[model samples]
Target chain A: LAKTTQPISMDSYEGQEVNITCSHNNIATNDYITWYQQFPSQGPRFIIQGYKTKVTNEVASLFIPADRKSSTLSLPRVSLSDTAVYYCLVLFSGTYKYIFGTGTRLKVLA
Target chain B: GAGVSQSPSNKVTEKGKDVELRCDPISGHTALYWYRQRLGQGLEFLIYFQGNSAPDKSGLPSDRFSAERTGESVSTLTIQRTQQEDSAVYLCASSQGQGLYEQYFGPGTRLTVT
Candidate 1:
């Protein structure tokens, strides 16, 4: 099982870049790292996914080093709307199961 | 196309009562998942169903919780003798396939046990 850990909370001002890192010391070789953002009273929404290196989508970017033991989610020029709980999940390909972390609460102040 | 949807946006039940929650996945989705989220907590995997395979109940908290799915279309999660600890948001998600695909989530059903 690939258990992930992230910071409990973070605060960032509007228009600033925010980076949330997750540690997964036991990540498997075929495990894929994915990120999800959730707002109050709503289900989580997918943000980005990556196996290694970096993957940038319209909403966010995911960075993973060679060891694949950790990854970082980068949100550029965050706004108030970006305030939500972000979770780092490890997708086990063999079992097709997802293990979610406690998540990082990001508060973007305007 | 419509996304994943759950019924009875909110449900409140008394202790020791039985409650059932429903989930409707996307049209062609082959994988469905159930999860629970407590107040200010991350999602907890409950169960998973893929096509006609046996539903994965490894994540279920106890025998009081059971789920069933019919032909990958709809799924129902039943909690028997509900307790205060079962009070949380029950979420449903579906994906095109079980692999490394993106999961679309529903609004979720808030289950309140009093």
Candidate 2:
């Protein structure tokens, strides 16, 4: 598993776009970048995932550079409910082992 | 299409007692995993099971911690002689075939050992 580094916390305002970036300098060729959102007292929820380039879903978008060393999760029109801890995970395809690092805590204020 | 479910949502046990944490993975999911989350901390990988193969117990913290899965259905993590340090939320997740697939998680069992 590749070690990931992210900011401890970030603050955003309502209706504004928020981007959380993660750095995985030792990322492997087979690794995929995935992001998860965790709310208080609930399990982490899958947000978006991408191997390279850009992937967009109804909820969020994932932008991965060609080098794959880093990726960013972009949330459009943030709301107060969007406040949560975001975890960036670098996992190998077809493996069950996932190492979760201290994620970036996002706070969307009104 | 129920998600992963864990039992006892909360478990309060005394030191030296054994406790069991259960996990019911999603139907047809071939991979199941166990993780621990300490208060105000990150998730810690505990174990992984795929179908009927032997589970990967390398992440088990100590000899006192063990987990078992029956077929591809349910799994139980047994903590022997629980201690105060064992207090944390035990999480369970399941994926389709593994290898970077998205995993669905349960609400998790909050274990408090006093």
Candidate 3:
């Protein structure tokens, strides 16, 4: 079973910064939080990943608290093209049992 | 365009028919994975293959679903007697020997069982 949970849907404006939070209270020490973005009719794309602290990439930023109970994905200057499903996955690298939780659908309005 | 690729972008078949989906992972990726996605849902893990190690088939929903990958290369997912519930997008991904590497996904095969 997937151990992560996030909002079902969210809405944002084109130029606004969007923040989506995921809760994984039972996250393990070896687990890493990875986020993926999927557009309609396309496979999911890698966004950002972090274990603790923060990790930023060209696409998005992943912020994980010290407790690792939750993490947030921040997108800056969102656009209509950014509207898609965002998945938060908790992966145990040792066991490799990667499960994708139901994603947060972000609809960007112009 | 060095990325994963799957065959038969769209396949429509009658119930009880068998279907084979193929996946070609990135050139040097040693870890390949298969997943299923229903409409407006997250991916469901199907199988995983790493190098020459035995595939982890723990996620296969039923015995009718089976996948094979040869020497960390092209992989094939074969479903016997496909059911209507099998109608979904089959996605394939690959990473460079796993371990904290992000998986790269393919366009996926949309299977519709009529």
List TM-scores of chain B, every candidate: 0.98, 0.98, 0.97
Give the CAPRI class of candidate 1: high
Highest DockQ model number: 1
By DockQ, is 2 or 3 better? 3
**Residue B46 in candidate 2 has what lDDT?**
91
Tens digits of per-residue lDDT for model 1 on B13-114?
999999999999999999999999998889998888889999878789999999999997999999999999999999999999885889999999999999
Kindly provide the TM-score of model 3 when superposed on the true structure, using C-alpha atoms: 0.96
CA-lDDT, candidates in order: 0.93, 0.90, 0.91
List, residue by residue over A43-66, the lDDT tens digit for candidate 1: 999999999999999999999999
TM-score computed on alpha carbons, candidate 1: 0.97
For candidate 1, list the clashing residue pairs, or say none. Answer: none
Candidate with maximal lDDT? 1
Chain A TM-score relative to the true structure, per candidate: 0.94, 0.91, 0.92
Fnat computed for model 2 = 0.83
lDDT of 2 by residue, B1-114 (tens): 588999999999999999999999999999999999999887888988888889878789999999999999999999999999999999999999776679999999999999
Error of 2 at B74 (Å): 0.3
Backbone clashes in model 3, listed as residue pairs: none
